[model samples]
Target: MPGKPIVSSNNAICLVGGAPIADDAISAVFTFVNSFVGVDGGADHLLAAGVTPAAVIGDLDSLSDAARATFAQQLNHIPEQSTTDFEKALTRVSAPVVLGVGFTGGRLDHALSVLNVLARYAERAVLLVDAHEVSFLATLGHVAFTAAPGTRISLMPLGQATVTFSGVRWPFAQTRMAPDGFTSPSNEASGGVVTIETDGPVLVTLPRAHLALAMKAAVRAK
Candidate 1:
C-alpha cells in the first residue's frame, strides 16, 4: 500500500518521527544524515524546526492539511494499517546506516514499537537515538566500538541469542539471553574497545557520548 519509494544517494539518512525530540538530538542526527525523511506528523515538526525533509512518508492520516499541501511534492503516502510509519519509512529508504531521532523518549508503546521494527529489520543498521542514549540492534557476527573505560554499556537480547562479549567488566561467554531470561544492564566497559559477538539478535545501548563510536561500528558492520 505504500507509494513510490524515495531513494537517497547518501549512505546515511535520518528518520524523524512525531515524538518530542530535543534540539540537541536533532542536531546530532543532522550531523550524520545527508537527507531527512519525515514520518507522518514528523513533517510538521521538521518544518517548525526550519528543516525541509527530502521526503515525507506515512499513512497521511496524522499529517495536517496545511503540511500535506506544503510538502505535497515530497509526500509519499501509504494507506495501509498493517505497518507503522516507522517501518514504512525505514523500508522505503536505502541507506547503509540510519539515525532515528524523535522515535524514542515518547509514549512507552511507541518507543517499544520502534524497537520491534529494529528487530524485524535487523539487517539494516538503524540507531534509535535520544538526548541521553543511543541503541541499535546487534545481529549475528562481531561488532566492535571504542568507549572510555568505565563507560556504561547495556546488552539486552531481543529474543533468543547466545553471545560472547569482551572489553566489559563482566563478559558473557556463550551466555543464553532472552527477553524473559538474563540481560546485561549498566555494565562498564573495561577498556577503550568493546566487542560483542552474537549468533542472533540483541540490543546494544550506550551513552550519548559514544554515538560516534556506535555509528562507526554500524557503518563497519554494514
Candidate 2:
C-alpha cells in the first residue's frame, strides 16, 4: 500500500525516477516545476544536477551510497517490495499535477511498469515526460488540445474503454479500445483543436513540444 504523504505542495511537483535522464529532458522539466522528489537512485541524478529534492521516497534498495549519505535527512524509506519506487514516490506526493522524468527511455520492462503505475493511479494528474513525448493518463476520461497539422497523437488504453476523437485524420467514435483488443498509435492531428472523450482511462501521448499544453489540459481534466 502507498504510505502517507512525504511532500505536499500547492504548486505542481516533479518526480525523478531511477531511469537515465537526458540533459534536455531535465532542462525541459525545470521550465515547469521547481519542487522535486527523488525516487531512490534518482537522488543521485538530482544531486549531480545540483538540485536537492525536498524529499526522497522509495524502498532504498537502488539508492547509491553517495545519494544515501547526501540526502540522509531527506530520505523517507518504505521497505515494502510490493511497489516500484516510482509508485511509492508518486502516491506519497500531493500536488495539482506531477511531471515525471527519468521514468522512461530505459529498459523496456521498467518503462512499461511506469505506465502501469500511471494507469493504476489514474486519478492523479500525472504526466510522464521523456526525450521525445509526454504521456498522461486521462483519468477524467476526456481531454482537448490544439496541435499543428499532421502532429502525432496517440491514445492507448491500459485496460478497456470506449473512446471518441475529433480533429484527427482517423477519427473514431465510442469504439472499444484496450491493450490487447485495439489501440491508436501514429494518429495524426488535423490542425487546430483536437478533442477526445472516453468512458474509461486512456493514456494520451503527444510530442514533447506540447508538454505545456498537455500539463494544462491534465490539470483541468478532473
Best by lDDT: 2
The pairs that clash in candidate 2 are: none
lDDT of each: 0.84, 0.87
Q: Give the range where candidate 1 is weakest over 10 consecutive residues by summed lDDT.
A: 1-10
Model 2 over residues 60-113: C-alpha lDDT tens digits? 888899999999999998888888889889889989999999999779999989
User: What's the lDDT for residue 72 in model 2?
Assistant: 91
- How big is the RMSD of model 1? 1.9
Q: Highest TM-score: which candidate?
A: 2
Error of 1 at 185 (Å): 1.7
Candidate 1: where are CA atoms >4 Å away? 1-4, 220-222
